[model samples]
Target: MCDAAETRPGIDPDRLSFTIALQTAADQIVNASNITGSDRGIAKAVLADPLPARRPRISARKVKCPMSRYGTTPHETRPLTSRSLTHLDITVLAAAEQPAVLPPSPANTDRRSRVFRLLAAADPGQDWTARQIADALEIGHLRSLSAQMGQWITQKFLVREGRGRYRLHPQWAKTPGDSLDSTTTIPA
Candidate 1:
């Protein structure tokens, strides 16, 4: 059941809600201490403070343009003036500079290319350890390079002659369709 006398025009709903929240906080502070002499007095003073009145609501139509007070319309435009060449300076320099070299292709800098270059430059009978290859190519991770070298040997890209040494696959060094192992020469 609703009471018709409960609502009051002087008491705003927003102010009532704010008062309720403040009352709850005050209650907590007052009940927290058993010796509530000074603390209770402070909470009481806080709760007794008058609630702020609800701000006046402005409708879109009722809102005044801020620019109207200045007696000037918002964003007034002015005509642009033509530019005049009052001062000018110029300089010329020789164009004998060397042409910029193109950056190396991604393939040329890849791990496969590095490995191929290293092996191709080695003597036919010479074998390279993983550390040697890594050191020559400035690769920091030895173990990882060693693993990749092993994989290359398994893929027949390189030959694993011994424990750590590797050589370019003999077939790659030989001419196409030439399977003779004795005739295969070292790559230039």
Candidate 2:
């Protein structure tokens, strides 16, 4: 029975109806105690019916919409309609064309420097929680700020007043523009 269901050379096994019949037979044999004689007869009858032919695989790719229908060709030019421009429109266009003046970047704009400046500018006695400092500096993640704070504590740049709270070290608690050392300092 297994030899009769064997796929011939160059023939696809999935296209053979005997493959499905063999699988059903194997299943019935494995559950022999559960499957009754009537169940076996029903399986035989179902397998006797002719199987539908499998459709050939489609090789062409499908597109949402054809490009030619909606798009214009390189040679196609849209007709320009001439209209008088109002005084307000001319003023608005001129203003938009002019380059916007942006504020100059701070000299010490690094994360550590910014944190140092913010903490030093505050009251020396005040203790800032991580959340408050993050909110003030617009920092998204507390973990990053916490890690930086840890490093600062080790460097003696910041002092941890309590849990989740930190303040600038007493030695570094000077006004902005006052130099702490030659290496690290708050910019004016």
Candidate 2 lDDT over residue span 66-180, tens digit each? 7733233344343333335465533444445768889897667777887887887788889999899999999999999899889889988889989988999988888656754
Every model: Cα RMSD to truth:
16.6, 18.1
lDDT of 1 by residue, 1-188 (tens): 01111233333333334454456567666777435454443334333453577664332222256554223323434323334668988888888989999988643556766777667666756888988898898999999998887787778889988988888897664343444232333332
Model 2: how far residue 45 lies from native, Å: 24
List TM-scores for all candidates, in order: 0.37, 0.41
Give the C-alpha lDDT of model 2.
0.66
**Top candidate (TM-score):** 2
- What is the Cα-based lDDT of residue 126 in candidate 2? 95
Q: What ranges in model 1 sit over 4 Å off?
A: 1-105, 174-188
> Distance from true position, residue 42, model 1, in Å?
38
**Alpha carbon lDDT at 140, candidate 1:** 95
* Candidate 2 lowest-lDDT run of ten: 1-10
Alpha carbon lDDT at 65, candidate 2: 73
Clash pairs, model 1 backbone: none
